[model samples]
Target: MAVRQRVVAGDEVTHVVLDREWKVIAPIEDYLEYLRQEQYSPHTVRSYAGGLASWWTLLEQRGQDWRHVGVDDLARFARRLRDRGSDPTVLALRPSKPAATSTVGSAVTAVLGFYRYHAIVGGVPAARQFYVHVTGGTMQSRSQYASFLGHIGGGQDRRVIGRRRGPSTPAPLLSPQQIAVIKDDAARFEDGNWLGDLRFRLLWSLLEETGVRIAEALLMRHRDWQPGTGTTAFIEVEPREDLRRRLRVKNQHFRRIYVGDELDDLYGEYLFLLAEHGFQFDDDDPIFINFYRGQIGRPLRAETVYDWIEGFKRRHPLLPAEWTPHWFRHFHATALLLAGIPPHVVQRRLGHQDINTLMRTYAHVTDDAEMRAAADWKMLIQRWGAAA
Candidate 1:
């Protein structure tokens, strides 16, 4: 875990909230501190920390030793994990079992992360060393391993270690009502203690309406959104040329979408406030500005979004549990597809690289549609047989 996030872009990034989301460079303690400094929503931090803690305890139990680990040791560790009745091959949830292979894979990757950090501070080993050797890690798993190591330096050297395979699975979705409740707080925030939070309403709203990622939402710039000529207004988002680049879109493809009246009106009102107070809408200006201290022209950063969401959760102590931005993504896609939107169209809207991703994530939701298609084919076959 790291404390200070790397500066959005800098030579030396002190552990800050931004660093928490951008870089995974800090030690667990610093990462934890950075999480606090960045005001990471308690629940988000808790979820990440809970996973990290499981990793940390496993490390301590294994004797925080990082200097020497080979593939054999890693394989042995995986075997040991399986022997202990941990989830053998599961990716996320396995409350019923000790843990699954996917989680075991995660634990292994976490250990590998520790060593990679050590290598950064201590220098690389003389020979190619294996921090985590997976019996089942194909090229696909290797890519996922790369994702986990994305935050650490020289992590690229670590071969991404998963099997080349199909899409894994979607995380569970928060109920629509639950999302509505969170949105309710956001709606009330038009006049809440946290004035900066008014953005949450728009932010959460956008995530639900479209399957945009948190980083994508935070990167929204004045120039990215285009109000079309007709009654149909669309916002054009292209992938940010650089991930570190602020106010940039996620994917590179030009995705033009119809911005519903609700969002358009809210965006209009926000910009009006900026104009009334003498704010400049420069070409490089970010759309979501931070008004916490009533400072004009201060754009909202990514960490600020997370912090705000967590804080919004604070207003409702009576609520059962807190939520994160990703949940909105799940809710958005699942709700739309279940409502009968075609998977391909949903994939395009969600900006997934493939239609299979949409189907795999919402397998339970899409199952019925597939069933209906199957029935139609079956009836057509029967009719053809009768004609013959």
Candidate 2:
């Protein structure tokens, strides 16, 4: 099955999956339409469509009907998805890299949601078999009385095929030295093109300073920047649309993050370079635009950033091969937490809605900080006893 994008009424886009004969798969299309009606983001609908297409492909290979599948079928499908890149026929002792657990989990979640929707609306009994209801403190119970809402309906039904998520690992960080190297490399004049170099430097600096998401950085407009007195500037990250892509800020919330004088100076230099190149931008114009690539003056796309990261990796083999622009944001958040910034304050700065999310993502950092504090406390006690 193949996924296709279609623009519906009101200029909204949606996705549907097609079979071998190029006919739209009715059930999948129905579920996708439901998602659209529920106002799910286009990206999410597209992802769910892709996941459903994969499931359909698996069913076709087994000659099994979607409505007749059981829990065992889903388990097998999950395993297949997890082991996507590994060739079972290969004889090598070292196994090929498998898909990330989160990727497999997303696909599984899409499939499960599809089945659940069909079970409720289309009366498919197979979907009902995938979930079981639990009460009290059984081994399979997922209830928690920690929160007020959890106490209301904590022992609700649980999916039998769901993957139990483990504690989140510490977010990968870019060391200050590595960030310095990257910014320095980006600032170098490439082919004696100062404009291009300045643009990249500003981009990297903005990300490092504000810790904004790549989408937020790309979607920012000049008007969103408030240049205050010397050494004090702020970027207002608001929900805005891009002319070239359907990118939107996560959580769709407005936040203002402070930037250092260094980044503000970089921005000034970038604007000066832009003026010299006769590319004047209005206040409403995107801050990060394509100055040297396709359709100059158009807002920069996220794909281009990824491409740049790949090229940077090639040029500097010492840098992490898997590094992306997101590492800057992670580095920023970790730095704030380690520097004694409160979790709630960091949450707002990073545009995270929940304080628990900040805590969970950087739990390792907090744990390490606590251990070090304990060591310092012990030393303080020892010194006090010696003085006495």
TM-score winner: 2
What TM-score does candidate 1 reach?
0.57
Per-residue CA lDDT of candidate 2, range 163-276, in tens?
756557778879999998888777764575552367778888888888998889989999998876754788999976542476778767899998877678678778888798
The all-Cα superposition gives candidate 1 an RMSD in Å to the true structure of 10.0
Q: Which residue pairs does candidate 2 place in steric collision?
A: none
Candidate 1 deviant stretches above 4 angstroms: 1-71, 79-103, 106-170, 188-197, 241-254, 294-296, 318-320, 368-388
- For all predicted structures, in order, the TM-scores are 0.57, 0.82
Tens digits of per-residue lDDT, candidate 1, 62-91, equal 565434546655565555554553433445
What is the RMSD, in Å, between candidate 2 and the native fold over all Cα?
A: 4.9
Instruction: Indicate the worst ten consecutive residues by lDDT in candidate 1.
Output: 11-20
Give the local distance difference test score of model 2: 0.79
